[model samples]
Structures are given as C-alpha cells and as structure tokens.
Target: SDPKAEYIGTEPWTPKEALEGGEITDKADIFAYGLTLWEMMSLAMPHLELLEGEDDEKEVEEDEDQSLEVSFDEDAYYDRLGTRPAVDLEALGNSYRRMVELFYLCTEGDPVRRPSAAQILQALESNVPLNINPSEVIVID
Candidate 1:
C-alpha cells in the first residue's frame, strides 16, 4: 500500500486501489500478466528473492547497460525466473499458443505495440495454440 514499500512476490499483486475500474487497462495486472508469460514459457512463477531487511532501494541494483537486457536462452528448459519451471505444452490446447504470443507481444520493448487489457482478452479468445511443444521448452536461464 505504501509506494515506498518494496514489491515482493514473483507475480504482481494488484491492490484494491489499483482496480478502481475507470481505466481501460491497469499497469499492475499488465506486470503480472507479463510475468505470467514468462511463467507459462518457463513453466514457473517468476520468483523474486525475499528481501532481508534491506531498504527497497538498496535491494534493487539493475545493470545500466542497454545490452544488459532480460532475455531467455530459449534452449535450456531447466529454469524460469530463477526457478525450475516446465510446462506440458502438449497438454495445452491451440488457444493457449495465441495467448502466450500475445503475452510476449504485450511485454515487448515498445509498449505501443503491446495490446491493452481489453484487447489482450479479445486476442486470447482466438486461442490459436502454437505448434511448439510446451514440453520441449528449453531455455538457458
């Protein structure tokens, strides 16, 4: 509830104030949704280490280089979000594919290309599952 408070879990948790509902899309859910994509791809909840009494500012130290970006190896499937996550893609339906694609799309570097919540919901309904076997999800974490 405090802006100064640190964010904890791997998945974003929206507050009641965040969902007042006037806006078409909420950034809070979008963040969680992005993590969900990584979750579905990596097959695990994106984990963030619990802070151990350090100030929130002190706990986060992001690399300044533009090249130091977040990327998945897409080869080693052992971990996602710093945790082991494997999904049974073969078990998922066609619709699931399109949803993941949309997740990745919404998480694009260019936010303009990302779809709004309403649009995301609409797009996911199409459900054109990807041919990539969820079980073969290899990634280098």
Candidate 2:
C-alpha cells in the first residue's frame, strides 16, 4: 500500500482494496468513479436504498434523556458480501447503458481485472463493447 494513497471517502465509495487495507491504486479511483456515475444517473446517494431498507427493519426508541447510537461496519459488509450499489441499466436509457457497462468493469472485485483509465477512454471514444472476454461480442439481430 502506498503511504500517500490513503482514501478518506465514505464507505459506499471506497473500493474493496481500500476496504481491505491493501495497496491503493488508480483502480481504486475507478471504483469510486463508477459509484459517482451511478449517483449522478440515479439522483441518489450510493447504497442509500440498501440502507433505507435496513432502517425499516430496525425500531428506534425516542427518549428525552437517551441518545441514539448507530453502528455499522461498512468494511465488514463489503468483505463478507462483495456487494455493489444496485443499478438498473435499462431504466437509465440506451445512451447510459454503455456507461453502466463501464461501471461494472470499474468496480470489479479484483483490482487487476478492472480497466485502466486509458482503456475506458478508448472504449468510450471508439464505441467498443467492454466485456471481460473481449472475444465474446454481442451481435444484436
């Protein structure tokens, strides 16, 4: 891990490598960028839907002298589940499908599997399909 590459962002935006205290690389940036794009398209905070669902399951008690306490292990959640922010590519429209595809590539659990900034740019510019197996191309009839 690079000493200077510490990430201080919120849990939802942090990558698996960063969550595991592993070496932070540009791939971490790609992970955060993907979530940011999701936020922009959905007009909502990342992981908010999941959190809200969890919130509904818990009961809160109000008291004049009592304080509310909340505890959540974001790192543990990622370590155990390897979950990503939910996205509906179909709802985002055809223009955004390409970007959503890139989002999945950027957030890959294996940092090495994630695409580099150059590759992402090239795919975007060339309108090439971004897939794990490049040999497998989808041909729409």
Candidate 3:
C-alpha cells in the first residue's frame, strides 16, 4: 500500500516532487503550466524523446506486417532526474527571452524556488524581469 505506486507512470507535465511521491502543492500547477508553454512553443509533445531510438525499430517491425506493441518504459524515463523538454529559445527569437525565463522559473526542480501564480501574473503584467540566476536556466533548445 504505497502512496507513490499510483504515480509511477504519470505524464511528463507532472512535477519532480509529485513523481517522487512528495507533497503536492499549488506549485505543481505552475510546473505543468510551464510544460504546456513549452509544448506550445515547440509544437512538439513533451517527453516524446523518451521514445527516442525506438521509432526506427518500430517502423521496421511495422513494415514487415508484424504485430507491433510498443510499451513506454516509465521507470527508465522517470529515473532520470531533472529531465525536462528542451525549448528552442533561438528559434523563438530574442523577443521571448523574458517569457522563456518565466517558463524556467515556473518549472524549477525545487518547488520551493518556483514562483507563485501571483508572482508570475505580476511579472507578466508589468514586464518585469525575474530575479532568477542564469545558471538556474536548465531548459536547453
């Protein structure tokens, strides 16, 4: 009767703490919102890379008219800590730096460091830059 067992295969939008069976908070929503923003900007599914290198094998199997059942390795995928979808900041252009920073702030690995919904709204409304350090920006294009 483990509480965390139910969360083993949660989606990529889930925050690290949730995946680790930690307490859920409002910041979890912020983490999900950050992934949503990444999805919108990248026009790609989050954590699709988890299936990387398997596509070719599946294609070959399909071409042979064989029954192909692909299974997602959730344990392997979730074991890699701090794995977030890459955001193509360069493709997004220079105009979106602040927004990108906000995305990073929202998805911070430590929930305690994540900005509250109110802080995010205030930054968006006033166009004020976040005080996050550059080293903290882990999402790479």
lDDT of 3: 0.68
Candidate 3: tens digits of C-alpha lDDT, residues 26-46? 667778888887877787667
For model 3, what is the alpha-carbon lDDT of residue 54?
44
**TM-scores of the models, in the order given:** 0.36, 0.64, 0.66
Error of 1 at 121 (Å): 1.2
**TM-score pick, better of 1 and 2:** 2
Q: Give the Å shift of residue 132 in candidate 2.
A: 6.8
**Winning candidate number (TM-score):** 3
Candidate order by TM-score, highest to lowest?
Answer: 3, 2, 1
Candidate 3 has a TM-score of 0.66
RMSD of each: 16.4, 8.3, 7.5
lDDT tens digits, residue span 33-116, model 2: 877877788897666443223557644456677886444456655554334677887688898887788888877887767777
Off by over 4 Å in 2: 1-5, 50-82, 131-141
Better of 1 and 3 by TM-score: 3
